[model samples]
Target: MTDTRKSTQNAVGAPGRAADGLAARLVVERGAFRLDVTLTAAPGDVVALLGPNGAGKTTALRALAGLVPLAGGHLRLDGAELDRTPPESRPVGVVFQDYLLFPHLSALDNVAFGPRCHGASRAEARAQAAAWLERMGLAEHAAAKPRRLSGGQAQRVALARALATHPRLLLLDEPLAALDARTRLDVRAQLRRHLADFEAVAVLVTHDPLDAMVLADHLVVIEDGRVVQEGTPADIARHPRTDYIAHLVGLNLYRGQARGHAVQVDGGCVVTTTEDLTGPAFVAFAPGAVTLHRERPAGSSARNLWRCEVAGLQSHGDQIRADLTGELPLAADLTTVAAAELDLRPGATVWATVKAAQTHAYPA
Candidate 1:
C-alpha cells in the first residue's frame, strides 16, 4: 500500500534517474500469507533479492515474469505496464532454479526453443542458439542431450536459452542452487561474467550472502513478504539492521539501549562499543574478534568479557568456530592448533573477551 519509490532510492546506473528499467509493486495472496514488495532496477543494474526461505522471494520473481498474476499492485518494464502480458509475450526471460532443460531436446534445441516460440524460423533460431552456446563455451555440447551435459554446462545452456530471447529484463531464481560445491564455484564465476556483460535490468533471488555480494549491484533483503532492508552489499554487511542479516553475514548482533560507550543488551550483559550512540542501537562484531581462554585472564585490556560455556564447536575453513552461551551468547573463531591446546569441545567452560574498539555500534 505504500509507494516507496521516492523513499528507497540508491545510486542506480550511469543513466541516473532517467535510465529505463523495471519498477514493480508485487502483491499476492495465498490463504493466510500475503506478499507485498516493491522492486526497482535501472538498466545495467543487477539486483539480488536476498532472504530466508518462504520469505516470498520466488513469488516476487514469478509475479514479475507473469507466471503468477498480481492480486494487487502493478508491474512495469521500462515505462510500459505488463500486468496483463502473458509470460511469453513480455520482454522478460527467466532461468529457473532447476535449469528445466527438456530431456528430449539437444542443447541447441533447448536454447533455440525460446526464439522459435517467438516466430523465428527454425534456421534462424538454431543459428542464434548456436551463437549463444558458443558464447557460453558450450558449442561442443550443442548436440548433447540434457542428461549428457554436466551440471555447469546445463546451467550455461539455461542461461543461453534465457538470453537468446533478447529480453529487456532477466529473472534468475537460485541459478546456482542445484550445483555441487565444486561445480558451483566455476558456474558462479561464469555467471558473474555473463551478468556483467548484460546491459539490461536483471534481478536474481538468492539466500546466500556471498552470492548476493559477489553478483549484485544492490541487495534487497526481504523478510515475511516485505522489504526489511535495501542497500549496497558493503553497506548491508557493515551494519545489518536485523539479526537474520547479522547471522547471514557471520556476525554476532545484539539490540539494546545505548548510553555513551556502553550498550545494555536485552539479555543481561552490557556491550562496550566504540561509537557513542543513543536510544535504540545495535552492537555487532565478527567471531574472529573474540578471544577465548580456558581460564580467566589476569591483566586483559578487553572491556567486554563473558563467562560462557561452549555449547558447540565446528570447523570453519582453516579455523575452529565455537558457539558459547551464558552471560552473552556469541561465537568465537580460533586456530585449529589453539583449539587443540585449549581442548575446546561441547560443554566446556571458557572465558571470551573482545576489545571495545572491535565492536561496532549503530542506530537500530
Candidate 2:
C-alpha cells in the first residue's frame, strides 16, 4: 500500500549548510496496537509528538530510532533513504527516558562513547568529550560517575552525549520526565537553548502540554495512532476541535470580557454587565452555567444579553456542546432538551444572557 504525505509546513527557511532534516511515514504493527504516522522536521525545527499515555507517541519515536521495525513505509534524512538501515548505522542520536549512562564510566567517558563508536581516535573522542561536557556546564564533573551525579546533571550529560556524535537527527523520549519539578524548569530552559543551537532535526515525544508548547514550533497531536490535530499553539487554543485539546489550551472560558458595567461585541453591539472591573480583563461563565429560556426575561438580575446564532452543536456524554456565532463567538454546553426547546439550529438567533455576578476577571 502507498500513502501520500505532505510536509504541511511553509518552506520559509532555507536549510542551512550545517544540517538538513529527518522525515518518516512510519507504521508499526503489534497484537492490539498499531501506529501509523508521518512527520517532517526542519533543520532547527522541533516537532513535538503529544498525546495521552498509551497513545502511540513513544511507539512512533522508537520506530524512527529503529528500536522497532516499521511494518511499512519509508524513512529519510535530508536526501538519503534510511528504511533498512540498522539503528547503529542510522545517523541518529537518542536520549532515552532513563538517561541511561554507563554505571562504571565517568561523565566525560559517557559523552565520549558516541564519538568513539563513530570511529574517532580515542584521544580525539576524549578531547571532544571534554568540550561537550564544558558546553553542558559539567566540565568540573568530567570525572564524576553516573552514581555521583544528580538527576538534572545526569540528564544534561545524556543530552551532551547525544550531541557529541553530531548526528543528523535527535530523538528525545520524555527528556524531562525523570527530573524533579524544580530541576525540570532549569533543564527545560537549558534544553531549549541547546535545541535552538542544534543545526539538525529534533523530534521529542512528550505527554506534557507545557513541554510540547515550549519546545516545539510545530505540534503533531496524535490519538489512537492517528494525527488528530496539528497546528500552532495559538490556532489550537482559539479553535479547539477536541475536548482534550480544550483543556490543554488554557482559557478562562467565560461568556464575556468584563467591562466597567457593559460588554461590547462587534458593530457597536453592547451588553450591559453588572460586573465592576477596570482595565483589561475577562468575564467567565461555563456552558453548564447558562440556562436557556423560551423568551427573554421580562425583568431579571441578568445583565449580559446577546442575540446568538447557533453555529454548531455536538454531543459530549450527557451534555451538549453548542457553538454560537453572532456578535461574539461562544461555546456553551446545555442539556439535550434545552437545546431542542430553544430550537438551537444553525442560523437561528436566540437571546442569550448571563448574570453580572457570574462574570469574573483575572490577569491576562
Candidate 3:
C-alpha cells in the first residue's frame, strides 16, 4: 500500500502536503473496477458527486468517511493525515439515505447518542442534543420516536445527530432521495441554509441534477469511476463536454470538424453557427431552438435545415417533445397547439430548421 501511494503521488505530482479544509486523491479498487478521483474544497464549500449508478459516487463518499480503505493516494483534512485512521476515530459524520435512527429511541436520545459515545456525560449530551433539535425546528418532537415522526422530521433528527458529533467533514448520501416531491422542496431549502451556515467541508452524493444544482457550490461529475468534469452549476449548464452532461442540462450536442462558421457533423450534416472556429469543434443547441415544418419552405431565412422523420413524441410540461431521426437525429420542443397543427406523429415526415444565431459552437 505504501509503494502504491508513492507511485500515485508521483503520477499526480502532489504528496505529503498539508492544507486546510479537505484535500484527497481517493483511489479504491474492487475486483475488476477501480475509482481514482482527486477532490479539493475550502471550508464552508458544499461539493456534490453526481453520476449514474455504479459510477463509484457512493464508494468515494465511503472512502472519505473511512468506511472503505484506500488502495492508493492520500486523505487529509485540516492538515491532518487520516489514511490509517479507523472510521470511529475519524472526524467525520454521515447521513445515510434511509435516515438510520434508532427505532426504539426517542428523538432526543437519538440525537444524544453520538455525544454520549464520545464520552460526554448524560446531562451534557442531552443539553447539546436539545440545542441541536431546537436549531432544526424539531424541539416539539423531542420525545417522539423515529417510527412516530414524519419523514421530514425524521430527516431533521438524523441531520442533528450527525452535526452533534462536531465532525470536520460531513458526508451525505442521496440526502433527499427518500422524500416525496413536496417534502423534498421544503427539506432541500432547509438543508441548503444549514450547509451555508456550517463552518466545515461537506460532500454530497446524489444522482438528481436539480438537487446538485440547488445545494452544491461545486459539482464533480463522475462516469465509469473517473472524474469527467467539474465546475459551477451555471458554467456546466452552459458548456457541457459529454453526452451525459448535455442530456442532464437539456441540450442537443454533437462533435465535428469546423471550417470557419460551418461545422460538418455526424451523418454528413453541416451546422451553421455564429461563432467562427477551425479544427475539431462541438456544436450545441436547445430543443426549443428547433422549428418543425410539414413541408420544406423555400426562401426561408433559417441557415440550417434538416429533412427528418418523427421517431417518437412525449409531453414536456405544456409543450410536446418530438424525437426526430433521418439526416440528423435531435429533439424539438413545440407548443401542443403547434404540434396539433403540424399533425406530428410517429413516422411522420417534417423539416426542421434552426437559426445560425441559436447554435453555439466551441472547441472540442
Give the count of colliding residue pairs in each prediction. 0, 2, 0
What is candidate 1's lDDT per residue for 1-364, written digit by digit as tens?
0122222222121122344699899999988889999998877789999988999999999999998889999988889999999887999989999999999999999999998999999999999899899889998999999999999999999999998887789999999999999998999899888887676788999987888989898999999999999999999999999988999999999999999999999987899988998899999999999999999988999999999999999999999999999999998999999999999989999999999999999988
Q: What is the TM-score of candidate 2?
A: 0.68
Error of 3 at 278 (Å): 1.9
Model 1 RMSD in Å is 5.4
lDDT per residue as tens, model 3, 124-232:
9999899889989998999999989988898899988998877788999998999999999999999887776666789999989999999888999999889999999
Give per-residue CA lDDT, model 2, range 1-364, as digits (tens): 0011122221222133633477789998988888999898767678889887888999998888889999998899987888888999988899999999999999999999998999999998899889888888899999999999999999999998988877778899999999999999999998887777677788999978888878877888888887888887656555444446655663324333446776553345554545565544434455654555546777756776666777888896798877776755567778888888778777777667766666544422
Q: Can you give the lDDT of residue 255 in candidate 3?
A: 92
Query: How much lDDT does each candidate structure score?
Result: 0.89, 0.76, 0.90
TM-score of each: 0.93, 0.68, 0.93
Deviation (Å) of 199 in candidate 1: 1.0
Worst 10 residues of 2 by lDDT: 1-10
